[model samples]
Target: MIELSREKLLLLYRQMLSIRLFEDRVYQLFLLGMVPSTLHQYQGQEAVAVGVCAVLNRDDFITSTHRPHGHAIAKGVPMKRIAAELFGKVTGCCRAKGGSMHIGDYSVGMLPAIAIVGSGIPIANGVALAFKLRKTKQVVVSFFGDGATNNGSFHEALNMGAIYNLPVIYVCENNFYGASTHISKVMKLENIADRASAYGIPGVVVDGMDVLEVYRVASEAVNRAREGEGPTLIECKTYRYSGHSRSDPANYRPKEEVEFWKSRDPIFQFKKKLLELDVLSEKEDNRIRSEVEKEIEEAINFAIESPLPSPEIALEDVYA
Candidate 1:
């Protein structure tokens, strides 16, 4: 449905593979007490971020939610810096300040990812407002989860972004469950994207498992914003493979539901589609997985050996 080059698709595979390994490692390390902070793993939600980010220019920006590793890699943040940030090292992208939840670099066009739910939406407006006021063609994409839709900041931001006709893309990765609550129980509307119509804006429901499907839909939204067409609200139908956080035992979800989602794993599904299209071979996919594993291992070693930020910096990065 979209014109994705073989090289770019390969790159997407690399990005997803990279994210999977990193998050998997983080999960393991968390269990081992290697990480000081908890994590909201972005395992199953990779396709949405990568697919959406592929349509964005480097000059454009993105705001990330608690689950930001996928978005960071998709946007070209190097593994070394990301791992270093996770280690709270001076070499980190944030200079060891914004650890896990705050790993972002404005220089890279990513506002330090806001961990608070729906908190980044209004900030996204300010970023887009700056672009619009300066008459720049840049667009800003704000990535959040379904829970964010229920936050008051969500409504306030949508209204503000719409009123000013800001160049923004409000992307909600509706993975069925919000922190543990099912969307059907929390949201009255059948489709979250459908709510965009209320603000007189385009709302799109996308297949988040298919990278190309997400890319095609997001491309239109991104292009529309860049062309001064204002913001769009996109709801991606996806599922998380793990619990809300590291301590979660995942007892809230059913075994069948988890198995069903696993059966449709984004990586396997996309690999199948790529192979069917003669875009990728199983051999290449396996090799890519090997490479990704190696990269993550090296990143972990780098983080382990890197020195932690000075204790004094704890107070420095808090406000300044």
Candidate 2:
């Protein structure tokens, strides 16, 4: 077990809570038609993002999938800019162009998220290649869902990453369902990590709902990559509490499964652990919760007050 100081543990807790609350608020905003497009909220899968990112350096790169808000937040992109992007305001990370799916800030080492399934895999591989060629110690992480494992890009990227010993981490957030289809209907392998052997890379499975466990696994993978030992494939067994997208009701999943996952909600479990460790008191917990609530409220207000990109500017940033 990686022993973290109380402050570091609290930081992780805050991040997980922020993601949960942010998604919750975004859901409300989507319902009120405040968000310009359909959203793929990361409600229950907070631990995977928080854990992986918490171990990364500020210079490390991360490629995110369509469901990117939690990744963006955990990777240290300013929450206000993310909220602004969601609201289609000019002050967003992508200047209101990318919106929910593509929210990212390269200045913070985050790539503008790739909304296409499995596209980020090669992109992350390419980035890791660049880092290797440049002799930079920087590492890249590719975050994708279980559905992406089936994509050709996934296989090709992992193969190249392994052959070249690229400083990249392939993080598969296996949330049980690929959109609406269950993993059993698609994959024959009992574990996604089992596929790493074919590529000559180390593969490990971690509990996605437990932030500490995910962090422990990610720390080892990141260290290995930085040491030029090669890439590692980490499969996080998680679940998405909400629908695949705004249009999805997620009724395809059984109620019992959903409830079972909910009972293991990352924030609640981590918070309880913190209290047991005597690192967080009930009063401190309440204060932290209130502070996060205030931050989200302020972020929403900032987004609402920011101006939208002018109609004339739509043609301004177009590629030649």
Candidate 3:
């Protein structure tokens, strides 16, 4: 595990808490009919996004999958802007167009998240290609789920990235279920990282629940990429605390399995680690939580107060 300084550890904790709180709030809002779009909450997979982005510079790019709120937050997108975007307000990053699935800000080097599974894989490769052609040292990280691994685009992108030695990191947040289907029913491989060998690149698996372990592995992979090495496939073994999407109770998942993963909640685990290491005290932690809660409330208020997008510009931002 990488030894993190107190400041860095606290930042990671804050980011994880922000994501957790943001998702919880969004879920509550959706239940109250405040948000009209579908939501794929990133409750259990916070460590993967936080750990990976922690090693990245501001200029580094990341392409996100449908479950992208955590990626945007971890990549430094402002909470108010993200909240506004989800509310479909004029002040939103995408002017309320991208909704819950496609939240991101290019100003922070994060692309508008791709909702389709496996689509961002090749898009990340393309971004890396642009960086390489410009002779820039920036790298790209592509976030996707295990279901994406089975797509043709995933293989195609990996092959191209390997051949050209693109500076990109492909992260598969293997939460064990693709939508409602278990991974076992789709692929026979015990671990998704094993597929990286087919593309002739290094494949690594880490404890997705452990932020330090994720940071350690990602730091090495990121350094390698910045040095002009090829991409790396990192399979983070994680589990989602919620169901596949809104209104689904995740009844397919066994009760024992759900409880098991909940016991390993990344936020809970990291808080315990910090306390044990003397890096944080209960009083300080409580203060942090209070501050974060207040921040989230401000974001919600901002989103609520913001005006809805005008119909005149509805078709204005389209690329085509």
Candidate 4:
């Protein structure tokens, strides 16, 4: 509706569908104890990552959190590699070293996803700093949670980003809770993006459930950063239907709250919007979903059959 091309819209919808299906598959696999590590599923916030990545160039970057399957796929990391990494295979993106929390493919410009909350902020700032020093138009997109906004790293990163006019987009995916603690109880600010004023930068709030809305807002921020207009704080108001971790009982929240957000599922909403726009027929939608399902199954098979990392290799990257 905002002059977006049909091709771009279909691509956006595909990315959103990929994330939704991938995350759902990951959740099911994790519940069966097939995965060795903990998972912070990005089930509900697919729109934020997909939308932000849509407007990015191949040379641009993104930082991810523990809930990073969506970010990885959006950034163009192959599912086979992500699945292999989760299985600790040598063919993984990180050679099975990074696992679920740290899956990233830097060759395409996705820096190693920082799993520690708010830790990627400074690293992304440094990447932007390098680009700015070189006078290139590259921009780094940093993704963090609401709890991260309360971290010292978040404050420090924003301060430095402001002072240096770094080419970076700070995307705060506020999925309400910071590992079970609601944003309402933690910060006094009504909108996390409003905190951008403390550093004298533009701040914005967008509906994270709506992919196009996120893309529109993020396009502005990415362009501004590339043009040396400095960084902007974009707080994506989203909700994660899953628990904080696959292990958590999610006792901190109410069932009604979970259901409320679930009803507004990003994947369903995106498909509906696409249908309304006449961009896809019901048969075409089902086919797309079926394709994703087949790919996921193949990835699972590949991961299961892949060779595990050598025991000697465990000591290989530890020091060097």
Candidate 5:
């Protein structure tokens, strides 16, 4: 087991809670028609984002997928900015241009999320190559789903990363479904990590529901990349509490399966462990919860009160 300081543990818990609350609030707002554009939430997979990002420096970069709120939050993007972007405000990180799927801040080292599956893999490699040529220790992480692994880009990118020994980490968040299709039906291999062998790089699989386990594995991979040991593919076996998008009811999943995964909720499990270790008291946990809730509420209010982007500037940032 990795021994984390109380402060680090608390930070982890707070980040995870923020993601849960943020996603929940976004869903509510979407239902009320307060939020524009569709949402791909990141509720059950908070641990995967927080754990991996916790080990990265501010200079290290991360490429996100459509479900990028958790990644942006974990990488230190201000909640208010993200909320404003979802509201399509001028104060948004992308100035209302990217919307939900493209939310990101280059200042924080997160690329505007790519809604295209498997596309971020090569982009991450390109960034890693620059880092290598510049002799910088900066690393890049590519976040993608199980479906992306089957894409030709995934294979081509991994092959290049392996041969060049670039400082990148390919993270596959396998939630057992590729936009509602079960993995069993599509994948012949039992584990996605096994695909790493074809590219000759280290591949690790971890329990994504356990934040500490993920942190431990991610820490090792990050350290390896920083030292120029080449790319590592870390497959996080996680789940999404919501459907593929705002419109998906996720009725295809069995009730028992959903309940089972919910029972092993990352935030709940981590809180329990913290309590057992005396790292957090019941009173402290309650205080943290209240504080996070208040923060999120304030962020929502900020987004609501912010002004929308003017139509005149719509063509300013466009590249034809």
Candidate 6:
């Protein structure tokens, strides 16, 4: 693994911690009916987004899945904007039109998340095509779940990307389930990355729970794409600590299974690693946590104070 500077390491820790705290706070607000619409919390898979986005430039793009809060934060979207979006405030990244599942900021190179499974795969390819046609060295990373790998869009998009050598990275955040269905129930293959061979592209599997490992693999893939080597299918073996949705109890999963994944929590593991490397101390870690908490609180206050969209202007941005 490539050595990371102390600054970068701390930034990664802060980003992951921010996502964890933000998601936890959102869940609390959701229970209190403060957040509107449905929610898909990104509680356990912070490493994948933070790790991958760390290797990207500000001009590079990323297409997020329904559970996109982590992606938005990792891509430099302000927490206040995301919180505002979740609260349906006018200051939201999408001006309140897109809520939790649709959070993104174009200025930060994140497309408003596509709620449809696997839909963003093709859209990312289209964006990558634009970059290629324009002869820009930009790349687009597409984030999806294991379930999306089964969708026809996934296959078609990968094939097209391979054929044209599009600068796109297909990251499969395999959390072991599609909603409530486990991956083993649908596919016999041991690893999702193995499917890359069918499209003549490189495929790699990484420990999604380990930020450093994810970063190492992502760096290679991003470099390959930037150098005109084409796309790669990276399968991140991760898990979600929360239920599929706001209303899901997630009881379908066995108790031991949940406990096992929780034991390897990405944020916890990363913090421990940093401490071991002497890159962080107990006091410093506490400071970071305290700062993150304050930031989350500020974001919540900003979203709460922000005004809702005017009803008269409802159709202002509607093109249809």
TM-score of 4: 0.97
Question: Could you tally the backbone clashes for each prediction?
Answer: 0, 0, 0, 0, 0, 0
Off by over 4 Å in 3: none
Residue 268 of model 4 has an lDDT of: 87
lDDT, candidate 2, equals 0.95
Clashing pairs in 6: none
What does candidate 1's lDDT look like per residue over 95-213, in tens digits?
A: 88888888787766787899999999999999999999999899999999999999999999998899889999999999988887888898899899988987888999988888888
lDDT of 4 by residue, 1-320 (tens): 46799889888888888888888887788778877878888888999999999889989988888888889999889999998888889988999889999999998778778888999999999999999999989999999998999999999999999999999999999999988788889888889998999999999999998998999999999989989999999999999878898878889998898888888888788788889989988999888889989988998889889998888887777775
Q: Which ten residues in a row have the lowest lDDT in candidate 5?
A: 311-320
Off by over 4 Å in 6: none
What lDDT does each candidate get?
A: 0.88, 0.95, 0.94, 0.90, 0.94, 0.95
Q: In model 1, what are the clashing residue pairs, if there are any?
A: none
Candidate 5 at 78: error in angstroms? Answer: 0.6
Instruction: State model 3's lDDT.
Output: 0.94
Give candidate 1's root-mean-square deviation (CA, Å). Answer: 1.3
Q: Write the per-residue lDDT of candidate 3 for residues 216-311, one digit (tens) a residue.
A: 999999988989998999999999999988877999999999999999999999999999999999999999999999999999999999999888
lDDT of 1: 0.88
Candidate 1 deviant stretches above 4 angstroms: 318-320
Instruction: Compute the lDDT of residue 29 as modeled in candidate 3.
Output: 93
What residue pairs are clashing in model 5?
Answer: none
In order of appearance, the predictions have TM-scores of 0.96, 0.98, 0.98, 0.97, 0.98, 0.99
* True lDDT of residue 318, candidate 5: 72
